[model samples]
Target: MLASLAMVGLSLMAFLSNSFGQERKIDQIYLDLDKKYRIPEQWTVLPFELEDPYKRIKNGPPLVNVVNKAKVEWISRWIANPKKVVPNAKMPDLGLNFEEIKAVIVYLSSIADKEVPQVAWDAFLLKKDDELSDDEYDKMDKIYNSGKGVWGRARCTICHPIKSVGGNVGVGPDLGEITTKINRNWLYDWLKNTKSHFPDTMMAQFRFSDSEIRDIVEFIMRDTQFMPEEADEEETTEAKPEQQEIQVLTEKEFSSIRKDNALAEKGRDIVEKARCFVCHDVKGIPELMPVVEKKRDNLAGFEKLLYEIRCLACHRIQEKGGTYAPNLTFVGNKIKMGWEQEFLQAPDIIRPLSQQMPKFNLIEEDAKVATEFMDKYLLNKELPQDVFKGEAPSPEIVSMGEKLFYDKGCNTCHAEGTKGGGVVGPNLATVGDRLQPAYILSHIKNPQQANPQALEPNFNLSEDELKAMVGFLVDHVKKKEEGK
Candidate 1:
């Protein structure tokens, strides 16, 4: 089988490196081979080992380091979905060979700024290749100079803006801060043969000669300025100390910025820089946002996405979702704001559902923003006086609703305050105090209207039946609250 052959190859490589002789190049070559198969470079560089990945860093190493937790999870996922990655790749039936896993394990176990596991790995591990030479350095300016022509003529400027002066598609990530976070050699490798890094990363590999690549890299690395001509002007001005004396003094004298939500904001900057909204939903707002695709037709687009996602598939807000998720309509009252903020930064499996929740790999700040957003918008607001204006619905209505709540299988998915409903939906311990009457009214009128084609049944109640149901739902909360 192909898996058998791949394993043989991996074992042979392992033998060559570990048993045959201690030649490190065997490992290096294997690493390179492994590198070719990666999508999104599976490997990453982290800034620090701190709990926070989005911490503001002054400066140190030239590239980011991979977070161990992130790496392990990715490995687990790769094991689960191997065929998606390797073409004709079959190995020990686990999608990855023991040798490959072992090598990666060693890399994962080691800390950053320290020696990595593989032999002769010091250079790559330390990113020594990231350093640029004097001639290479000298050419950086030239690259910037020709950028106007190169970026302008290639149609790249049309899709990707430079200094906010070009296209609107945002097909490419912002490049202004690219130099600060990524390895220089990565840029080279990306320019030279991009697909080799991550088959999924979209940047196309242009048929660029080494000289052209150098030109492009230099243009990209000029730091603050976009034009080589402007860089010359900056250099001229910087040479005169007297001209920048006041500015320098102002910078040194500036007071440190202290804000009410400094830690949260500091985390936010990193989230925006990483641009986490490109794919996964952040869950704090009215609806989730996709990362790379846009749904543009306004109300129609919003309606289309809600219907497609089937909110009830994984979540319940009122009467929608899969039996494997949680109801979120009343989530605001249940959790502390700051805790929500922290969880968004890095979510751990607190309670596993039948299906594992997918991680968005959100940077810390994106998590914070999600936390802040949910706390602000998703919670309850009292219903209009006209709605609550009537006395609480009759006890018969409450009794009937309660009977329907069970007969219709409401408890099949929702647990009473984490009691016995299917773990798939929200716990209903405090729903009464958490949702406004109008909120419930709006949701039940058209389960699809509140959220399109919501997994919850569109009970299709007549106006009188709807009123009975609303009265029942509204009363369920108050009774539960009192019992608690």
Candidate 2:
């Protein structure tokens, strides 16, 4: 995760508050109630996911899917035959029954685009909790408890599940009653890159700003609410009107970062040349870093640090940006010395789920320029120790690596010899004689880069690991040309 503590404070208090609870059954108390209880509203439900309100679920008399034969058969059983087990939908029957209601309800609930309840929503809020102060009660009642934000903003209800309420989708673990389990900074990074902080975890990286992040932290552990009104009215009015902002300070600190404004403003024609926004936020930009983790860092230096860590917004090159690709921060730690040059000179496909990083068509010199900048200046740390060691596998080592190869289940798709896996790749029989170690290394680092449509997986391998694996493949097996 990018920043853990930031997310803790960023989560709004309402998300974690025990002030509300589900009191009555949805079916018994609200669903089966008389028409007088909720009938005044003529309803037109819309899916929350539709970006534009006008483009909601197609308003019509209602349509149903009939793709599967079993579904077609199941609906037929109760529609015409009229089974006793069918349920009722409360709408006056033009011939509708319980089974149709059951079928419709199940279908509607499964769709991501669905509407919030229009009636009895206020009554449901009263059921969230028994004890509550007047102040807390008033604030809680102002907005929809559904947890879906008005616009595109992140909502605690979107990520965290609260009892039977909220999106109730647990993409991340339930923070339901567990705030103390996380540290402040750790929470911030978790919101930044949950999978990185705890590899292969279920959290999605939410790019939020520092202030909103802080507000969430307070809501989760301390104040438990975001009442901008709670601040002193006079100071709130003035609101730290400082001329020297965080954005200015960060640009000065990390001046080497490549920017369109910095060069193009100087007649370098660099203004819109780089699609920097895709990866780098470049500060003072609200469209970037729209949401904060609400746990770690404050929203104070957002404009400044946007350029400082411009890599994380959407494209992760190393660990700086979004996790759309490899953590680009420590890329040097994983690759061999020559492999970087090849990868940059000719871009290759890497991750399977994503579009291949397009080749910038950098003539050798420019490729060298970017590669050197990344290696020497961009990453101001020691290169990965022993990452470039080219291990030449011997018969015994190849034999040993073979066990690890099969044990790790490498043969599912990649076959070796006369056993295991389907044959899809150039057989490794003569791989040792044809390909150079650097080429193999580059392919392993970013599979898509090697062959655009290659079915090869992006193992995200360290140079040392790729060397060992390649040595085993090249030396132990040999591929022959078709006619040779």
Please name the candidate that would achieve the greatest TM-score relative to the true structure. 1
Per-model C-alpha lDDT, please?
0.44, 0.38
Residue-level lDDT for 3 in candidate 1: 100
Tens-digit lDDT track of model 2 for 1-484: 6477668756645554534543544675565576433422322121111121112122111211111111322333323332211221111222434333333323322321322212222343343334546765555444333122211134344334443244333232334333323333444444444433332222333444454444344345332321112467887788585753111112232233223343323321111132222322222232542322222233222222222222233334322234433444434333443556776556443332233343323356644654554444233132222322556666665675566556656676565655646454544444455345555556666778644546677766555566567666656423333433
Give the Å error, residue 46, model 2: 48
Candidate 1, residues 150-170, lDDT tens digits: the string is 543344543345545543333
The predictions' CA RMSDs to the true structure, in order, are 27.6, 32.3
Backbone clashes for every candidate come to 29, 83
Q: Local error of candidate 2 at 401, Å? A: 0.9
Model 2 local distance difference test score = 0.38
TM-score to true structure, per model: 0.29, 0.26
